[model samples]
Target: MRHWRRIAVTLLPLLFALLHVSGVLHLQVLERLESIIYDTRLRATMPGTMDTRITIVDIDERSLERIGQWPWGRDRMARFATELLDRQQVAVLGFDVVFAEPDGSSGLASLQRLAQGPLAASPGFSEQLARLTPELDYDARFAQALQGRPVVLGYYFTSDRDGQARGVLPTPALSRDRLRGKPLRATSWQGHGSNIEVLAKAAPAAGFFNSITDSDGVVRSLPLLAEYQGQYYESLALAMLRVATGYSDLSPLYDAFSEFDHDVLSGVILAKGQSRLLLPVDPNLATLIPYRGPGDVSGGSYRYISASDVLEGRLPEASLKGQLVLVGSTAPGLVDLRVTPVGRTYPGVEAHANLLSAFLDGANVLQPNFAPDFDVLQLVVTGLLLALSLPLLTAGRAVLLSAGVLAGLVGLNLWLYQVQGLVMPLATVLVMALSAFTLNMVYGYFVESRTKRELAALFGTYVPPELVEEMLKEPERYSMDAANQELTVMFCDMRGFTALSEHMEPLQLQAMLNGVFSRLTHIIRSRRQGTIDKYMGDCVMAFWGAPVATPGHAELAVAAALEMTQAVALLNEEHHRQGLPQIGVGIGLNTGTMCVGDMGSDIRRSYTVIGDAVNLGSRLEGLSKTYGVTMVVSDTTRALAPGFIWQELDRVRVKGKAQAVTIYTPVGTEAEPLAPERQQRLATWQQLLAAYRAQEWDACTLLLRNLHAAEPGNILYSLYAGRVEALRVLPFQPDWDGATQFDTK
Candidate 1:
């Protein structure tokens, strides 16, 4: 029974762990925790230096100011792209901006409209408009500059309610027909804001620059492939990778489970003429953003060159030669800023630069199909192992075990991340293991300790004067204000006290009662650190784990109850020697949440509890006499203090309670082993109760007779024997549930 009770107690943590593993409860807090861990690991492992291959053509505040507040003429943009390609000799240029509308700043549209309309008859106006058209046609000039160059245009996808599609979309990297009959639930979009027809047609290739942000509004990962109208399109970084590697076809990979209805996206395969590269992706077909370091312009991960510098030819030709340039704005007014793992406020264009670098360097973070399964397995195995093992091991061994497990989990996660480029979840498993360890350690330190210093500090007044002075050394921490807390409460009463009191005079009886209480109160307060609530005539009420909380309060209370029983025996012996009446005590204990403080009126008050648990404790004390036992404890306390040997008393619905509660009596602590004869008697007692509850009167009577013969002084066995004989002659209802019901408190 004790072993089962301990196992039940240990399984409490497993319940929380299983919830996490099964995905029944999504812990948003853990996602945030994971984000923190990821950021920390990323920061610690990053190479805090620039990648010279990728350069960001930043349209910074300076460029915006010099270029006269954006919406820059296409002629200027044409000049910028032309300068980087022709003069600087860059390998490939990718724009992070969408030219979604025609350039109207040149006024060429109006001039052409006039030339073809009312001004057609005016030869002078027609001739002059045709000559000025060559220089004023900014869109044509920009398109001409992009021709024959390794340039990829940028576009964006939107899932807005309006579903409005603007401008022209480039050819998708992979068609939906190719992914037919497969579970390819990529991030889908209904509409797009794309480049104008001329710009889209002139660029060698194009890709969407839309970035998806997490719930926390951070760009930690981006979908490499998005779906629109049943077609798949590549991201800006993917397109750049294809152009850089000369890949012609992009293929989607899937991992299908035979038992599951759905398939998870594994990765994307980029196939060139003969060589192919497989890039890993999450189930969403997204890749984690592999940041280099703090993405600052001064000595950071990537070199940032102002657009104005590129256009003005201020940068050295050799610096830009063979570099991959990403053109985007860093001007605050342009709103091209993003929050990334590396930097809170980062340039959106640099994100693509980082992604491109990750691809070329084969550093993309992969979350394989089995990652979730592995995480759940890790959580269950490690959590259950630690939960079961930590209780048995010493504190030092527990700490060492926790450290070893933590180190192994972290070490393996880091190895997968750094060496294999896998990004398995570390937060959930790590948090569960750490939480289990810490909870167990805290319970051992705070609850398992036997020190009574804190108890003395709170209940010093009830102790001897010398002990009170020692407790008062630091008196400020103690208080008596009413507060709610979890505690173990006890109620004890002297049996047949009224009959004993009637024979004595008032003063003499008062003196006897006071003497009895003084002795019992000292045992309760001095040994167990219990607070004496108040004495109700012949009864004394006390509680543990109050005012100052101690772990294993239930165990302490039960132990105190056993000692009090012994104290009563000694007191009775002394009374017999003095020619006074001897008395017996019945004690009840319960553990639960209750209000414990100095609760009362201004004129008169007392520190006490008022809750269902307190009422139940008092009720159990009343039942001790009815059951012919010295002590009765609720099932809650029994379960909490598994280190003690207990006898199952009864399951009863007490007055004022709707639920039936099982009760027990603490026979002894494990430190004092039970005798073999007593153990056999207990086993027989259990069978007798089972038979009694089953209403097998003959079987119960036989067992009870044997038990009484073995221990004739055991009143509990004699009491049940009487009940079985009474029921034999009485008629009972057919629907009896075997649970005793008390109609009175």
Candidate 2:
């Protein structure tokens, strides 16, 4: 039974891992960790080689600085297209840009408006404008340059801003009829920013340049195809590839070859009669970006030719001949930078180029559709194996087994990733295995120390559980035998509990008492680290510095007393809301030498304290009601705990103790200073005590009145006033101490 129990305990992590893998539990940190792992693997194994076949014409900072700011004259753009295609002789040209609106950079609109309105009758203005119209029309001139060229313009899809769209979209790679009534799960967009009708017709082939950003805002993949308005469009890389390969027909290739085709789109099959190529896609109809290197020319990834250099004809003729050229901007002002695994400020255009190269190399890495199901199976097998076996083996063997399991899992995962380009989910399985090993090791250690726990359960009633744990570290030094130590003791009693018990039923009173005790006990034991002696009726007795000698026991007890009073005050708040009587607590703290140990009769031995100081603490608790304060601290406690602001109450001699002890009520901690008026009251009360102790009854009388008036309905002041009035009649006595002697315990 215990073996099975240990196994079950160890399997708890695996249960949660299964839920995480199955999507029943979504942990963002787990996803983030998985991405970090994937990123690390990618960075470690990337091919740092450049692709000479593709080139980037970057509108960089130099180009912007030399040729004026962006949205430059479309005539300039037309010159760029003409130069790259005619002079540079690139095989294919793609613009990682969208011309959604007509360009007015040539000032043709103003010229046309002048010809129509103010300058309509100007000399030769209409005829000259008609002759220069073809040259001044920037968009038309740019479109004419792109006409009949093998160019694929890039656009992007957006799912924001209410899906509002502008301009015209290119013909989709796959129409709704091509889907054969089967649903394909691809990235879907609400709208797109496509090229204008004139440009779209001039270069009819285009693809979206939108990159798929992970939850961590990282571009790890690009959708090979996206869906919009029941039609599927290809990405820039896919379109560029198809144009280079004689415009192949795109078809979905599922995993299985049945009529239903396995219900999974594994990849897209591009066929141009006898020349077929397979483009594998993940579940998102996306391909993982096999980054060749860093996205800069210096990183040996791709050739980056500045737009200004290209337009100025700085490059030798045919320098980039037969290469697929991508026209985009790399300037930060262009807002085309992306956060990617290789670098933080990667170029968005380079992401598409990376995917294009991955297409050419056929080195796509993706998680299969059976990933989650396989993860579940793997988790169960690895989890149960570790859960059941780790318990039977020794510590050394267990460590070895756990280490071996981890190494084996990692080896297999890396093997599959490197050999077959499969990106299996390794985070959850690795984490589950580590958690299982940790839980098993912890359980084993706890089981081996059962004797200590048994001893703790035995002595825990006498001392605190914390003390018991410390005591076990050196068992020979600690025992239940009596020992004398300077400790702080407390006696807390509920003031209105007697009245509550009279009106409430037994069950109700019991519940309220338990609730009150629970809160107060937590403050004393957990917060202050004080050991509870016992509870008697509505009173609880606890002491500090017992089995484990704590030097700051008095300070701990004082803080605990203050919090216990606050807890009762909060209880009274709920009582006031419920229309029940508000309750109060009186806690008394005393510090002195006391005998503490497990002491009782034969069959009912219990830990308790019995000394003059403990009895005096109980006596001080009763004095709280007489003085009308919540807590009373003895001079011993006040002296030890100097971190609190103190208000001197009185000196009193209880029935058991002959020596008179000064007591005080805690005003607040040093962190909370007494207000000005209260400080004055405290100062005046000190003088009143001086007058009364000096046998100056007349002076005491006047001070008592002022003190009572400062605090209306103060019992301590009222008590002193009656004492002075009664003492006024008696003759003044010398050698008199101002200690209020109590006759009862």
TM-score of each: 0.60, 0.60
- Estimate every model's Cα lDDT from 0 to 1: 0.82, 0.86
Tens digits of per-residue lDDT for model 1, 1-745:
2122233344556566568657887778887988888888887888877898998888899998777777789999899988998989899999999999999999999999999999999999999998999799999899999997889999999999999999888888887567646546679888899988988889859988888798888888888988888788899999988887788788877666422544467788989778989888887778888888777586388888889888788987667888888999878899988988778778888878888999998888867778878887888788778877887789899899989999999999999889988878888887777777777777666644532465454455443454455434433334466667888999999986886687888998888888888888887888887878888878899898765557878988888899889988998898789877778999989999898776668786666787989999999999998888899999999998988999998789999998999999988889999999999999998998888888899999889888878988787877787778878886766776677889898
Q: Native-vs-model 2 lDDT?
A: 0.86
Judging by lDDT against the true structure, name the best candidate.
Answer: 2
Return model 1's CA RMSD, one decimal: 10.3
Question: Per-residue lDDT for 20 in model 1?
Answer: 65
What value does the lDDT take at residue 413 in candidate 1? 92
